[model samples]
Target: MSTIQKDSAITLHFTIKLNDGSVADSTHNMGKPAKLIIGDGSLSDNFEQCLIGLTSGENKSIELKAQDAFGMPNPDNVHYMDRAKFVGDAEVEVGTVMAFSGPDGAEIPGIITDIAGDSVTVDFNHPLAGQDVTFDVEILSVE
Candidate 1:
């Protein structure tokens, strides 16, 4: 069996859970594992550290902090825009997630936090940011 190492693409089953133990995501639930290349920045450095020496068919659980996982919510990502900016038949309501073209021409998502008269407050932070998360991993195969 090949051992998981840096830059190796390994197939594994993983579950992301909150501190409360409720699962946020899991491949075992789908009955299939996911494949990812090691050291590709797809997994956090902390998450990768836990798999460094694991071989095929190994199972382990790893915990990561906010900074090591999805990272802290950045205040700068939050912005307030004119409610009119969201024109058309769609109602500009609070808690609605909308995507708009950013300066880089890519679509950026922002959630409406408040709907003030002629103004809408939006936050673009990741939903999981600023929170610690845990990963329960089951190595299915390594190559």
Candidate 2:
């Protein structure tokens, strides 16, 4: 009978839906739950706030704004890289997702925004950036 609080290990089945009620992601379909350590950096503070008071076997839905969700897309996040970088056989087509090294040594997954002549434009922004999303959570366990 543990309560969900900061530093709690929470297990939940969740479905992320858009404002239009379109399912973006769902763990319920997989028949397995996901666990998140409260206060972890994996989730934003706003997202964590929504789960702070939930108990086991609870169901809740929370709405998140663009900023509170994936955050607003920054113009600077979009970059144009040399086409030579993509020497592999994978089609360098627009809308393709690729991973590139970031300044912090993390692989930043970027979307191929454009491909012209010798320059292949890549956007390093999160795919869901600037999008307002909703989280539909079913608290499977809280400890």
Candidate 3:
């Protein structure tokens, strides 16, 4: 009967639904419960707050504002790249998610938002950014 607190190890199944009731993500879809420690920097502070005080075998539905969830889309994250950068078999089409190397050499995923002649607009913001979401969580264990 451990209530979730800071640094608590938690095992849970969660479904994230958009405002339109569309399933955005779900651990159940992955066929396994997710395990995480509170304040591990994985879940945002606002998201982690919703789990506080929850015990094992608890079910809760939490609604999060766009800014509180994945957060509002940052205009700076939207960049316009040269169409020439995309070569070879890669299709230059809208709605395609591509991974680009960051300054640190890490792969950063960006979605093609627009294509205008030689310019291609890629949005690096999270796909769910700027959208409010609902979290349905079933806590399997909390310690």
Candidate 4:
């Protein structure tokens, strides 16, 4: 049985739940295990640390603070864009999420929070930011 190490590629079923016990994300429901290499920056450092020595068929449940999980929300991530930006095919209703092009041409998801006569409030913070979370992981394999 191989233990997770610095560069270990592992497959695991995981679920992230908020402090209120509401699931934020889960791989088990999709019937597909997630595969990732440790220390690859795909997962947060605190999250990777929780799997440092686990072997195949092992399971762990860890609780993480808001900062450790998704970091606190930054006010600067909230922006008010001109309502004209959504005139075309973009939806303008509140609670709608749209992806805007970033500086490097990457898609940045922003959720519409409010819509006034000429302005639309968009929040770019990750939905789970500022909330403590619990991670339930079942290690299936380590390579």
Summarize candidate 1's per-residue lDDT along 34-100 as a digit string, tens digits.
Answer: 9999999898888788899999888888889989888899999889898767778767888788887
Candidate No. with top lDDT: 3
The local lDDT score (0 to 100) that residue 132 gets in candidate 1 is 89
Clash totals, every prediction = 0, 0, 0, 0
Off by over 4 Å in 3: none
What ranking emerges by lDDT with the best candidate at the front?
3, 4, 2, 1
lDDT (Cα) of model 4: 0.93
Every model's TM-score: 0.83, 0.91, 0.94, 0.94
Worst 10 residues of 1 by lDDT: 83-92
Tens digits of per-residue lDDT for model 4, 78-140: 999998778777668999989999889999999999988998999999988999999999999
- Model 1: lDDT of residue 95: 79
Full-model lDDT for every candidate: 0.87, 0.89, 0.96, 0.93
- State each model's C-alpha RMSD to the native: 2.3, 1.5, 1.1, 1.2
Off by over 4 Å in 4: none
TM-score of 1: 0.83
lDDT of 2 by residue, 26-58 (tens): 897787889989998878899998999889988
- TM-score of candidate 4 relative to the true fold: 0.94
Looking at model 1, residue 22 earns an lDDT score of 90
Candidate 3, 32-75: lDDT as tens digits: 99999999999989999999999999999999999999999999
Clashing pairs in 1: none
